[model samples]
Target: MIRGCIKTITCGKKLSRNTKHSNTSNTGNSNRHLPVYAKVAYILGLRVSPSHRRMGIGLKLVHRMEAWFRDNGAEYSYMATENDNLASVKLFTDKCGYTKFRTPSILVNPVFAHRLTLSPKVKIIHLTPSQAETIYRRRFATTEFFPRDIDAVLNNKLSIGTFLAVPDSATWQGTDHFLSDPPKSWAILSIWNSKELFTLQVRGASRVKRTLAKTTRVVDKALPFLRLPSFPDFFRPFGFHFMYGIGGEGPEAVKMVKSLCDFAHNVAKERDCGAVVTEVSGQEPLRFGIPHWKMLSCPEDLWCIKRLGEDYSDGSVGDWTKSPPRISIFVDPREV
Candidate 1:
C-alpha cells in the first residue's frame, strides 16, 4: 500500500506549464482533448517519508503519475533532478524505464556594482503580461514546457518583469541610446525573483571550501582590483535574479545575448540581488555569449524523460535510447 503521493499536472491547453513546473487553473475542460501545446505532463513535488523508503512506494507514485499523464493528452512526461542523485536515477531509468536525455548548463554570475551602457542599436522594452505571453508563444513555440499562460509567470509577485531587447526604431529612440541604426535581431528575458519565492540554504561545503569562500569575499572587499569571486551570503536571505526564456538567432545573436545578460545583471543589482542565473542546453549556439562563472557551472542538472505516446512533432518527446543530433531544453522559472 502507498502511504505517500506524487503531484502531477494534466497540462490542459489553457494551463501554464514548464519542465519540472506547472501552474494549472480550473479550465472546466479537463475532459477535452489535449491542445497542441498541452501534450506534456509535468511531475512535481514527489515525496515519501523516510520510514516509507525501500518499500517501492516512490516507484508506485511515479507509475500512478504516468498513468494519469496518458489518460490526459500528454505525449511525454519529464522531470529534472540533480546529477548526483543516484537513487532517483535508478528509480527512473532502471525501474521506471525513463531515459536520461538532456543535461543543460546552469550558470551563475554575480550581480556586481557595475552598469553597462545600453547598445545604441538596441532598446530594452518592459513588456506587459499580455504582450509577453503573446510574443513568447510565437517565439518559443518549439521550446519545451513553455507556459501557455505567460500571465501567470509575469503576474506572480516573485517576477520582476519580462523584458525584450529589440532594435531602436525610428519612431522610438531609447532613452539611453539613439536609433542611428537598428540591430538585426532581438531577444526576450524573463527575470524571476528567487528571494520572494522560497528561501535557499546552501550547505555541505568542506572546511577548506568554506575558508576559500571567506577569503574571496575579503579579497573582493579589500583589494577591489583583483576581482575575485564574490560569493553571496548563503546563510542569510539574499535575492537571486533567474533569467529565463532567452531567444535570439542569426549574425546578431551574440550581441543580443550579451545585452540580455547585461540587462538582467543591472536589474538584479538594482534590486540588491546576490546573483544572476540562467540555464541553456550544452549545444545552444548562444551559450558562450552569456556571461557566467566558468568554474562554478558545469551542467550538473540531469533531465529525464519518458514518452507517454508516439507524437514527436513538438520535439518534447524524443528517442533518447538512440542519441539525437540536438536536444531541446526548456528551463521553467518555477522549476528554479
Candidate 2:
C-alpha cells in the first residue's frame, strides 16, 4: 500500500532581482538593470499515513520532489498552507530549508440572493485577450512573481474575461491608446472559472448549524426582497469564481474597484458559483476595495519558498523572502 504521496507542478518563470553583496567576487554591474527570472515550482497535497509519522518519510518525499524540480529546471520551489498548520510550517521551514516568503490573504465573498448594484457613473469595459495581455505586460511586468506565460493564462478556456472600470465621465479613449493616456480613475481585474476543474465542500458542521443554514437559505429564497444574508450549501460540492490581477489608480480608484467587485458578484450569481474569491498581498492597498466577509476569508495565508541547487550563495539572486512588500503580486489563477 502507498504510505504517502506528494504532488508538484512547474509554474512559469517569475521576475526577481539579485541583491548585490559586497563579498561577491564578481565586479559586474548590479543585476538590477537586467531582468532576472526564476523558474518556479509549487509543491502541494503532501500526505503521509498517520501510522508513519516521524519516520522521515515526509522529508524524503520533499527531497525527492526538490530533486525532480531541479531536474525540470526549476530554480525556486514554494508551497502555501494555512498559517496555523504548525506541522507543515515545521517540516517546510525547519527541515526542508524553505523560508517564509509571502503572506497573502484569501478574500471570499458569497453570492447573495439580491444582485449587487453597480454605480451608474462607473462603466465597465470587457477587454479582449490581446488587449488584456498588453495591459498586464506593460503595467505589471516588474511586479514580484509575475508569470512569464501570461499570454497562455489569458487565452485559457477557464479565463472568463478581463475588465476595466472607469468613471463614465472620462472620455473613452480607444483600447489601443489606453496605455498612453489612461483615465484619471480606473481599476482592472480578471476572472477565472474553476468549477469544472475542482470543487469544494465544508465538513464537520454541527447538526444545529446545518439546520440553521438550511432554514436561512429557504427563507432567503422565499423572501429575496428582505435581502436576508444566506449562505450557499457549502456542505455539498460547490465551485467559485476567482478574481485576479486586481489593481487600480487615482483617488477614486477605490470606488471603481468596488464597482468591479459588484459586477463580479452578479456574474458569479448568474453562473451559480457559490462564491467569488481573490487573493491579495497582505500589504496591498487595493485590498480595501475588495468586498469580503471576515468570517469566510483567510487573513494570513502563508507561502514559503526556497532556492534549489548550489546557487544559494549567488548574490546575483536576491533573497526573495526579504523582498519589500510594497511591490504588488500577480496571483496565478491556474495555481488555484
Candidate 3:
C-alpha cells in the first residue's frame, strides 16, 4: 500500500514523491514541497492531513527534511513563523537551533501609506505626464527595477517619499516608498555612509536557480493569509525604525541601534516598532546585530536558511542566500 501511494503521488516541480508511505500502516498521505531555496535548506512545507497533527507527524516530517538537507550539502538550517505563531516558533527556536528575526513595524510599510506621503523632511511630490517622460530615461541609471515601476506609480498618482541625503553631514542614504513599483510591497531605496548596503544588496539580487519554480507555487498558495492592505497612509513618523546594515556599519553600529530603538519607543511613542530591520547579508551585515541590544525584543534569532558559513555572526549579521528579500511586518500591497 505504501509503495502504491508513492507511485500515485507523482513528483512535480513544486512537490516530490517520498518514501514515507513505505510502511502503509500510517493513516494519511505524506506531503512535501521542494521550496525555491531547497538547495540551500529545502524549506519543509509539510502537512499530514488535519487528523494527523499530534501523531508526531510534524516532528517526523522535520527530521525527514533535516536528513535531506544534510545530504544536499546544507551547512545551515533556517525557518520563519509569524510573531504570534507560538507553536511554530517554539518548534524551531526551542527545539531546533533555528533563529528568529523581527520584521519592522507595519506603519512604514502600509499600502495605503502609498496614498500620499506629506513629510516635512520629504514631500509627496506628484509626477506629471510631462515629468514622467524625462525621469523614465534616467530611471535605469543605477538599478534595473525602477524604470517600469516608476511609470506605474506615476500613473496611479502614487505618493513618493525619499530622504534627500544631506551632503557631507552624513552619507546620502534615505528610504522611499511607493505603491506600484516593485509590484509587491512598498519599495525601499537606502543610501548609507559607505559601500556596505551595495555589497549586501546583491546577495539575493536573484532568485535561487534551484528553487524558483516551487517558490512561485508557495507564493501562490500562501498569499491568502497575508493582510498588508489594512493599514493606511499618513502614519505618524517614528524615529525608531532601522533596517539591517550589510557589508559593514559604523564603528558604533551597536550603540546606534540602541539609541534608535529607545527614541522610537520612548520619544516617538510608536509601540509597534521596537527595533530596526536590516539586509545584513551583503550591504549591512549587522543590520540586525544590535551589539548592546537595549530595546525590548530588539534582537532575536533569525533562521537564515542560506548556508554562508559558521561565522554567520548568528542573528547579529546579514546572511544572504538565494531567497526572496521580504520586508517583514510591512503592509500587504494587494490593496495598493
Candidate 4:
C-alpha cells in the first residue's frame, strides 16, 4: 500500500533528499534530492490494499512514479523483483522495460546479520547526520544519494540496515554498518547459524584506471563470500566501472574495489557464504588489470542502452588518464 511521501531538505542543502520518515509514514514527501542527479526512482514496499486488489493500483503507481522521476531530472528510473514473482516481473521488466541485473543473492543471519574486520589505523565508527554531510562533500563531487555520501563502514545506522568491509586483512582490520538511528560502524561481526547468500548487482558502471604499487592488493581480504557450486545458465555476474560518470580517476576506483572485496570476504565468512562473483564486460584498460575472481555465471549479459529524449550525452571534458576496474553492486533484499 504505497501512499504519501515525506521528503526533507537540509539547511542550505542544494537538493532536499536529506528527508527522514517515521513508522507512521508511508513514502518520501518531496523531490528536492531527486532533481539534483541522473537518479533512479524505485517504488519500494509496493502492495495491494484489500479493495485495491487487481485494480491496477500497483501498475498505475509505477507509471505515476516513473513520470515523476522523469519530470524531476532522473535519466534512468529502476526497480527489481525476484524471478518467481510473476506479477512484479511482468510489470517492471515486460511492461515498463526495466532490465534485470544479474547475480542476485539473499543474505540472512540467525543471531545477527554480518561480520566486520576494519583496520586499526583507519578506525571504523558511526557518523551522526552532521558527520555524514561533511563526509559527503569529501567523497562525492556530484550525483549522490545524499545519505549514501556518508562512510557506511562506521555508520551504526548502516549496520542495522547492512554494510561491512574488511580492509588491510594482513592487519585483520575491517568495518561494519547497521540500519538504526546513528547507524553502527563498529558492530564487528555477526556469527550466523547457517550459510547466507552474498549477492552484488551493477546498477551503473563505466571505465576507469589508476596506478597501484605492484605489492598493493586490490581485493579486500575479508568479506562473507563464496562462489556457489553451480550457477544458473542465464546468470552473468556483471561488473561496471563507475569512475567515469562520477569523475574520479582509475586508481581511486581500484582502491575502492579492493576495499569492497575485503568487505565481501568478511560478509561471506560471517554468514558462511561460498563465493564472490563479478562479470567484466568489453574489457578496456581500466576494466582489465585487476585480479579476476571466479565467474559463477557467463559474461554475455549485454547491457542495451535505450534513450528517450533530451541531451543523452554525459557532459565531461577530460579523458580518463588511467584505467581502473569497473564494478557495480546491485542488491541483497533481506527476506527476514
Candidate 5:
C-alpha cells in the first residue's frame, strides 16, 4: 500500500554574503562562506498514513527526496512546518540532520466587505514587469532564498503587478535613477492571484458555526455600512491574493507598507478573494507594518534546512543555522 509520500522542487539559489549573527532565535545567515550562489530545493506535502506511524516510512521518504535533490544539483534542501508539529520537527531535525533554519510568520487578513481607506497623501504606482525585475535584482539580489528566475516570476500570468507606495509629494523619475535617488519614504510589493491556480476550503466546521458564518455574510451584505467583522464563506472553496517582495525604507516606510497592505485588501475585495495574505521573517521590523488579524495570523512557521552534499568545494558554507536574522525576506509567490 502507498503509505508515505514526499515531493521536492528546485526553487532557486541563495547568494553568498557575509551576514551578522543575531541574538534572535531561528533566524540564521543562509550563506556565510559559500560560493557566489548555492542552489536550493524545497520539500513540501510530505504525508504518511496514520496507521503507518513510527514505521520509519516518513524518514525513508525524506531520504529518497534528498537523494533526488542532490542528483538535481541542489546543495541545500528545506521544508516548512508548524511549530507544534512535533512529529515533523523530530523527523526533520533529529533524524534527517536538518537544522531549524528560519521562523517566518504567516500573516492573513480576510477581505472585508468594506474597502480599506488609503491615506490621501500616499500614491501607489504600478510598475511594469521589466521595471519590477530590475528593482528586485538590484536591491534584493543578496537576500536569502531569492530566486534566480525572478523575471519569470514577475512575468507569470498569476502576478497582478508590482506596486510602489510613496508620498504624493514624491516625484517619478522612471527606473533609470530611481534606485540611486529613491524616495525618502517608500514601500514596494507584488501581488499574486492564487485564485486561478488553486482555492482553499476550511473543512470539519461545526454545523452551528457554519450557519453563523453564513448568517454573518448575509447581514454584512445587506447592511454593508455596518462594516461588520464577518468571516468569509470558507466552507466553500475560496481564493486569496498573496503579497510578496514586501519592503520599504525611511521612517515613513512603515506607514507606506501599511498603506500598500490596505491597497492590496481593496484589490482582493474587488477580485472577490476571500483573503489577502503574506509571510515575513519573524524578526522583521516591517512585520508591524503589514496588517493582519491576530486570530488569523501564525506566530511562527518553522523552516528546516539541510546541506545536501558532503563535498565542501571551497571551504564550509559556515553553519547557516547560526546565522542572524535579516530585516526583509523575499517570499516567492509561486510557493504560496
Candidate 6:
C-alpha cells in the first residue's frame, strides 16, 4: 500500500506592491502591507492508510513535503483541513510545527429550495475566460490562494463558465463592454461541475444528515407529479456545481450576491445538479442572503500556515503566535 502521500503546489512569492507607487520598495515602510504574500506552497491531499498509521509514516511524508517546498523556493507552507479531523490537526500542529490560522466555512445550498427573483435593475452577463481573468486579477489580487492561472481554471473541463452581474444603468450590452470601464457594483461568479471529477464522502453525523436529506429527496421527486417543480437527486454521489471567484463590494453588494446565487441555482437546475456549494471566510459579507445548511462534517474548515527557508525567521512576517489571528482565505477552486 502507498501508506501516505501529500501533494503541493507553489504559489507566487513577494506579491506585494505599495498602493501609492505600485512597487515593492522598503523605502516606504508605512505603506508596506502587513499581509504581504511571500512565496507559499499549498499542501493538499495528505493521507495515510489506516493499517499503516502510528508508525511515523504521516510525519515522514510531511517532512519530505516541506523539504520539497523549501527546495522549490517556498518561504511558507500551508494546508487546509476540517476542524474535527483530530489526526490531521495533530499531524500539522504538533508534529509539523505549523500554526493554526484561518477558519473558513463551506456552505451548501440545495438547488431547488426556493426560487429567487432577480432585480429588474440588474443584468447578468456571461464572460469569457480572458474577461474574467482581467477582472479577478484586479479584484482578488489580495486574497490568499487566488489562482495565478485564471485562464487555466476558466478553460478546464470542470469549468462551466464565468458570469458577472451589473447594474442595467451601466448600459452594458455584451461581455466586451466591461473591458474598457467595468461598473462599480458588479459581482463575478465562476461555476464548476464536480460530478465527473469529484465527490464528498459523508462521515459521522453527516451520515445521519444524509439519511434525513432522503426525506427531502422524496418530496422533491414527488413534486413534479403533483404539478410542482421537482429537484434533482442530491444523494447521488456526485453532481454538484461549485461557485468560486466571487468578489464585489458596493452598496448593492448583498443584492448582487443574491442575484448571483439565483443565477447559479438556475444553472445547476438546468444541468439537473444535486446542489451548489461554495466556501468563504466566515466573516465574508457575501454569506448573507445565500441559502446554506450547517454540515456536521464541515461546520468550519481550518487553514494552517508555517514558515520555511532562511527567511522563515524574518521578524517582519510578524509573530503569528502573539496575537488573535483572523484570516480571510479564498479557497482555490482548482484544488477543490
- Residue lDDT tens for model 1, 1-336: 322112222222332343214343222122122333545566665678989899999998988878877776666777777799899888888998888877888998876544555688877788777667765554454454556656677788888888777766634344223122334566677889886776555677777777776666677778766655567555455778888878765587767778888888888878877778899888878777788887656576787777776655543333433445244355678767
Ranking by TM-score: 2, 5, 6, 1, 4, 3
Question: Candidate 4: TM-score?
Answer: 0.37
Error of 1 at 281 (Å): 1.5
* lDDT score for residue 197 of model 3: 19
Expressed as tens digits, the lDDT of each residue in 1-336 for candidate 4 is 553221211111233334433333222222223223233344544677868677778878767766766676555543434446677777666666666543222221111123444334222332344443333333232322222323332242322222222232212212112111112121121111112322333333332211221111122222224322221111224222111111112233444333444454455444434433333333322233223333333333322111223455442311111112233221211211
TM-score of every candidate: 0.73, 0.86, 0.30, 0.37, 0.86, 0.78
- What candidate 1 gets wrong by more than 4 Å, as runs, is 1-38, 113-122, 167-182, 206-229, 235-237, 309-328
- By summed lDDT, the worst window of 10 consecutive residues in model 3 runs over 1-10
Better of 1 and 5 by lDDT: 5
Which has the better lDDT: candidate 3, or candidate 6? 6
- Summarize candidate 2's per-residue lDDT along 163-219 as a digit string, tens digits: 999889766566656666678789999999988799999999998999998888888
- Residue 263, model 6: lDDT of 89
Model 2 vs. true fold: TM = 0.86
**lDDT tens string, model 3, 192-285?**
1111111111123234532553454345335634422222112233223332111112354433333332222221222232123332222233
Residue 312's lDDT within candidate 1 is: 52
lDDT value, residue 116 of candidate 4: 43
As for lDDT, the candidate ahead, 4 or 6, is 6
Worst ten in a row by lDDT for model 5: 1-10
For all candidates in order, the CA lDDT equals: 0.66, 0.79, 0.31, 0.33, 0.79, 0.68
